[model samples]
Target: MRPFSKSLAVQIFVGTIQRLPQSARPSGIYKTRVNMPVYLNINGFEGDQQADLRVHGGPDKAVQLYPVAHYAALIKRFPELLGKLAPGAIGENISCPDLNEQEVHIGDLWQLGEALLQITQPRSPCSKIDEKLDCKGVAAYIAQSSKTGWYFRVLEPGMVTAENRLVLVESGNEHYRLCSILSLMQQNESAAIGALQRCLMAPGIADNLRLKIEQKIVHLNRASTGTP
Candidate 1:
């Protein structure tokens, strides 16, 4: 594992569970920027809540980090969303400049303030994004573009704040870049089977994500052999 030489500033955000007025479904996507320090535990930051534990807010998906650069690209793609979308628009807990899917790898570990965090997997964009942004196809656009951010699991809990900087302590497999993993996930052909297998073996990978990858490989193998 290699150490990241430079540290990047972190902007923190957190939100509580709220019911969407349109769908009545509970969501934690509407985050507010935090100027003060907040405690981060194995589950997540204090005051942050996930409506549905089945899909969000666990040890594996404790914190979500989105790149600030992607917001510019998104606005360029959808000019109408110029004012609607920004750093915390996507429900990310952290926004770091120049740190997108391509720059990070699965299983990478970083120190934020006094806490330790490990990159687990790329966040899967859902319909909630469309609802939150009040625009259709935003979720699909993020998924297709592979601009979807990634999640982090807390390895050592401590207080963190926007003033903190994310310093890489340990690097994950360079072969399993978050962008490549997200791309491979969208490809179901036999050609992607091998790559998917290797991604599953990456250290610090989220259990739920690993299970999904394993299932994809099984499906691909079955398709190639005409077993179904």
Candidate 2:
């Protein structure tokens, strides 16, 4: 609308990463992830091999990143960024919760008026998040849930913020979104591959996304569809 509003005074940042006790990567059908530091960009993006996977909070494993009030008490530690970042950053977030508990669970899908994205997995605990928190055992709990991280694949890449309206814009078909296919991959390889293959068919989905989906698909078979 504003011919790309990167100049619209949009504010964004890297939030805290919750770490856990050291643990080995779990034995799983998909990728192997070890317990480590996982970072959050306040507006919901968590760092991952994929582009920023949007989420609701820190892994409910140990530290919860939502409920802004919890984070507000912690924000005091960052005085220089007091007003600049949102002296009330956490407060503003808790006042209006975005994705609900059930929606965050694996296999759930959501639609925000900003864009029609679908969450596929949880933000797995990474070593970087552990370093930021200076804590242990954080990553283990995350893997227990099968390293499921919250992911919001962009139906449309649009701007976001801590002060967003936080609304549910659409209710999705249980099968069409990525949530339905992700869990199935562990048990039903053919079906999972079929579903993921369809997702990669979307118009603007990136090459990275295509490759990740193809990799998961290839684990069952042997060939990749997209070239990284």
For each candidate, the alpha-carbon lDDT, in order, equals 0.90, 0.36
TM-score of 1: 0.96
lDDT of 1 by residue, 1-228 (tens): 777766998789999888876898999988999999999999999999888789988999999999999999889888889888878988999988868887889999999999999999888889998887778888899889999899999999999877889998888777789989888888979999989989988999999889999999999999999998
Model 2 residue 227 CA deviation in Å: 20
Candidate 2 local distance difference test against the native: 0.36
**How far off is residue 164 in model 1, in Å?**
0.9
Candidate 2's error at 222, in angstroms?
Answer: 3.5
Candidate 1: the clashing residue pairs are: none
lDDT of 1: 0.90
TM-score of each: 0.96, 0.41
Which candidate comes out best when scored by lDDT? 1
Model 2 lowest lDDT segment of ten: 1-10
lDDT of 2 by residue, 119-152 (tens): 4333344543333234444345334433233344
